[model samples]
Target: EDKVVQSPLSLVVHEGDTVTLNCSYEVTNFRSLLWYKQEKKAPTFLFMLTSSGIEKKSGRLSSILDKKELFSILNITATQTGDSAIYLCAVFNSGNTGKLIFGQGTTLQVKP
Candidate 1:
């Protein structure tokens, strides 16, 4: 079975602080790893990593994948109270079947 695990289940930070979240996975025939930010009921897509050594970035948020280590990291800079949310990591299992295995998610709280 494909599995995703995220560390530091929860975090509390003040405004303008930076945070790093970790995610590791173990699966056969891995296709890709995806990151999402959940603020309300729905989760918003953040990044999708399919190759190692390439860093994907959007504003103060960025992520990198390490295929050799079967893990990924998400970095958030200058976090604000608005950045408080749950971050999710999911892995796509590729074996002629479409499946997504998700982690428990990391909840982040930012105080002003």
Candidate 2:
């Protein structure tokens, strides 16, 4: 069975603090892993890591994938109170099913 797990299910931090969120997964015919940030209604796309060791960055957020170890990490630097939200990790398999398996997600709260 395919599964994904995220560590530190919830976190509390002050503004300007840097945080590292972890996601590990096991899936059949792995394709890629994606990260998203959910604040109010919709979850915004953050990063998609495909190749191992190659990091994907967007503004203050960055993520990297490790295909061999079957894990990924998302890093946010100089966080702001507005950054508080639920972060989701999802995996896509190489099957034609076109399904995205998601983790329970990590809730992050940044204090001002």
What number of backbone clashes does candidate 2 have, counting pairs of residues 3 or more apart or in separate chains? 0
Angstrom error at residue 83, model 1: 0.7
Residue 33 lDDT, candidate 1, scale 0-100: 97
Q: Which residue pairs in candidate 1 have backbone atoms (N, alpha carbon, C) closer than 3 angstroms, thus clashing? A: none
Candidate 1 C-alpha lDDT tens digits along 1-112: 6789998899999999999999999988899999999998899999999999999999999999999999999999999898999999999998777788899999999999
lDDT of 2 by residue, 11-85 (tens): 999999999999999998888999999999999998887899999999999999999999999999999999999
Clashes of 1: 0
- What do the candidate models score in CA lDDT, each in turn? 0.95, 0.94
Candidate 1 regions with alpha-carbon error over 4 angstroms: none
Using all chains and alpha carbons, the TM-scores for the candidates as numbered come to 0.97, 0.97
